[model samples]
Target: MTIRMAQESDIPELAQLYQETVLAIAPHYYSDEQTHSWASFAADGVRFREFILSGTTFVATDETGILGFAGIADDGHITSAYVRRDRIHQGIGSTLMQTLLDYAKNHRIERLYAEASEFSLGLFKKYGFHVYDTEIVERQGVEFKRYLVERGVIKKD
Candidate 1:
C-alpha cells in the first residue's frame, strides 16, 4: 500500500470508505441510531468534498482501491480518520495517521488534537495522545460519547 495526499478526485471513494467504516465499526461503541446518523454525513457530497479539500487529507491505497484515509485541519485538529471495514487491524489507519503527523511536523505544527470515538481513542493513545476531555457530541439528533485527545509535537533530532 501507499500513502499520499488526497485530492478532489478521491471524494467519492473517501465518502464510501467513511460510510462503510462508520456503519461497520461504530456499532461496537455507538447505538444503531447514532451510527446511522453519523454515516449519513458521508452522503452529503458537497459538504464532504468541501471538508476533505479544506484540510491536509491523506489516503492509503493500492491496486484494489482506497484502504483508508485521515485528515488534519489547519489548526492541528484531526478532522477525520477512517479505514475501510475489511482492512482494519492491518496498519492502514496507523499508516494514514503517521502520514498526517509527518505532514504536520513538516509544516511546523506544535500539537495535534482530535475528537475520538471510544475505539479510536486507543489508537491515538498508541501515538502518545491523551484524553483531555469527554464530550457528548450530537449529529442528526443522535448523541455520541467521544473523547478529546491531544498529543504534543514530537521533536526529531
Candidate 2:
C-alpha cells in the first residue's frame, strides 16, 4: 500500500473508511444507539470532505480502494486517523501516521498530537506518541473516551 496526499475525489471513500472504523470499534466503548448516532455524524459528507481537503490529509490505498486515512490540522494536531475495519492490524495506520509525521516535520512543525480512541491507542504508542491526557469526546449524543498523544518533532526516515 501507499500513503499519498488525499484528493477531493477521495473524500467519499476516505469518509467511508473512517465510518467503518468507528462503527467497528464502537461496541467496545458506546451503547448501540450512541454508536449508531456517532457513526451517522461521521458519515456527514460536508464535514468529512472538509476535513479531507484541509491542511494535511493522507490516504493509504491499494488497487482495490482506500484502506485508511489520516488528517492533520493546525500544523500537527491529528484530527482523524482511521483504518477500514477488516483491514486493521495490517500496518496501514502506521504507514499513514508515518506519512503525517513526515509532513509535519517537513512543514517545520515541532510536535504532533492526536486525540485517539481506545481502539487506536496502542498504534499511537507504537509510533512513539506518549499519552498527554485522557478526555471524553462527544458527538451526536455519544461519548468517546480517548488519549491525547503527542510526539515532539519526530519522524522516521
Candidate 3:
C-alpha cells in the first residue's frame, strides 16, 4: 500500500468508501434508522471534496484504488477517517492515522481531537487517544452515542 496526500479528484472514491464503511460498520452499534440517517450524506461528493480540501487529508491506496482516508483540520481536529469495508483489519486505517499524525506534527500541532464513532473508539485508543466525553448525537431524528477523544502529540527526543 502507498500513502499520500489526498487531492480533490479523489472525492468520489472517498465518498463511496465513506458510505460503504458506515453502512457496513455502523450497524454493529446503531439502529437501522440511525445508520441510514448517518450514511445519507455519503453521496455528497462535492461536500466531501470541499471538506477534504480545507484540511490535511491523506489516503492509502493500492492497485485497487483508494482503500482508506483520513483528514485533519488546521485546528488539529480529525475531520474524517474511513477504510473500505473489505479493507478492515489490514492496517489501512492505522496507516492513514500515521500519515495524519505526521502532518499534525509537521504543523506543530500539540493536540488532536475527534468526535469518534463506536466503531472507531478502539482504533483511537490503539493510537493513545483518550475519551473525554460520551454524548448522544442525533441526526435526522435518529440518535446514537459517540465519544469525544483527544490525544497530545508525542515528541521524539
Candidate 4:
C-alpha cells in the first residue's frame, strides 16, 4: 500500500471509511448508543470536508482502494485517525500514525496531542503517547470516556 497526502476527491471515500470504521470498531469499546452517536459525526459532509481540509490528511491505498486515513492539524493536534473496518489490526493505523508523527517532526511541531477513545488508547500508547487527562464527554447526546494523550517531539539539530 502507498500512503500520500489526501486529495479533495478522496473526501467521500474517507467519510465512508470513517463512518464504517467507527460503527464497526466502536462497539467493541462503547455501548451501541455511543457507537451510533459517534458514527453520526461523519454524516455531516460539510463538517467532515472542512475537517479534512483543516489538516494535513494522509490516506493509505492500494490496488483495492483506501485502507485508512489520518490527519494532524497545524497546532499539533491529531484530528482524525481511522482504518477501514476490514483492514484493522494489519498495521495500517500504525503506518498512518507514523506518517503523521514524521510530518509533525519535520514541520517542527513541539508536541502532538489527541483525544483517544478506549479502542485507540493502545495504539496511542504504542507510539509513546501518554494520557495526561481523562474525561467523560457527551457527543450526540451520548456519554463516553476519552483520554487526552500527548507526546513531545524531539527535534534533531
Candidate 5:
C-alpha cells in the first residue's frame, strides 16, 4: 500500500470509509445510538470536506482502494484517524499514525494531541500518547466518553 496526501477527489470515498469504520468499530465500545450519532458526522459533506482541507490529511491506498486515513491540523491537533473496518488490526492505522508523526516532526510541530475514542485509545497509547483528560461528549444528542491524549514531538537526530 501507498500513503500520500489526500486529494479533493478522495473525499467521498474517505467519508464512506470514515462512516463504515465508526459504525463497525464503535459497537464494541459504544451503544447503538451513540455509534450512529458518531457516524453521522461523515454524512455532512460540507463539514467533511472542510475537515479534510482544514489540515494535512493522508490516505492509505492500494489495489483495493483507500484502506485508512489520518489528519493533523497546523496546531498539532489530530483531527481524524480511521482504518477501514475490514482492514483493522493489519497495521494500517499504525502506518497512518506514523505518517502523521513524521509530518509533525518535519513541520516542527511541538506536540500532537487528539480526542480519541475508546476504539482508538490503544493505538494512541501504543505510539506514546498519554491520556491527560477524559470527557463525556455529546454527538447528535447521544453522549459518549472520549480520551484527550497528547504526546510531545521529539525530534531525533
Candidate 6:
C-alpha cells in the first residue's frame, strides 16, 4: 500500500467514501433519522475540494482505489482521518496516523487532537491517545457522544 499526498482530483472519491463511512458507521450509535439528518444527499463537494486543496491531506491506496485518508490542520490538529469502513481493522488507520504524526513531528507540532466518534474511540486509544472528555450533543431529539482525544507523542519518520 502507498500513502501519498491527496490531489484535488481525489476529492470527489474521498467525499464519496466519507459519505459511505458516515452512512455505514453512524447507525451503530444513532437513529436512522439522525444518521440521514447528519448526512447531505446532494454531495457536499465544496468542503471536500477545499480540504484537499487547502494544505495537508493524505490518501492511502494500493492497486485498487483510495482505502484511507488523513488530514492535518496547519495548527497541528488532526482534522480528519477515515478508512473505508469495511476495510478497517487491517491497520490502515494506524498507518495513516503514523504518517501524519511523522509530518507533525517534522513540522515541530507538539500535540494533535481529533473528535473521535464511538467507532473510532478504541483506535485512538491504541495509538496512545487519551480521551480528555466526552461531549454529548442532542440534535433533533437524538443524542450523540463524541470523544475529545489528544496525543503529544512524536515519532520520527
Question: Which residue pairs collide in model 1, if any?
Answer: none
**After superposing candidate 3, which stretches have Cα over 4 Å from the reference?**
none
TM-score for each of the candidates = 0.96, 0.89, 0.94, 0.97, 0.97, 0.87
Best by TM-score: 5
Model 6 root-mean-square deviation: 2.5
Output the lDDT of residue 119, model 3. 92
Q: How high a TM-score does candidate 2 get? A: 0.89
Clashing pairs in 6: none
Give the worst 10-residue stretch by lDDT in candidate 4: 148-157
Cα lDDT for residue 83, model 2? 87
**Could you give candidate 4's per-residue lDDT for residues 1-157 as a string of tens digits?**
9999999999999989999999889898888999999998889999999989888999999998999998999999999889999999999999999998889889999999999999889999999999999999998778989999999987845
Q: Give stretches of model 5 more than 4 Å off.
A: none
Question: Which 10 consecutive positions of candidate 2 have the poorest summed lDDT?
Answer: 148-157
lDDT, candidate 6, equals 0.82
Off by over 4 Å in 6: 137-143, 155-157
User: Compared with the true structure, what per-residue lDDT tens digits does model 3 show for residues 1-157?
Assistant: 9988898788878888888889999898888898988888776666667877888888899999999989899999999889999999999999888887888888888899999998998889999999999999787788878899999987643
Task: Name the candidate, 2 or 5, with the larger lDDT value.
Answer: 5
RMSD of 1: 1.1
> What is the clash tally of candidate 4?
0
Query: Global lDDT of each model?
Result: 0.88, 0.81, 0.87, 0.92, 0.94, 0.82
| Predicted candidate 1 versus true structure: per-residue lDDT over 59-145, tens digit per residue | 899999999888999889999888999999999888988887887888778889999997788789988899999999778888888
**Of 3 and 6, the candidate ranking higher by TM-score:** 3
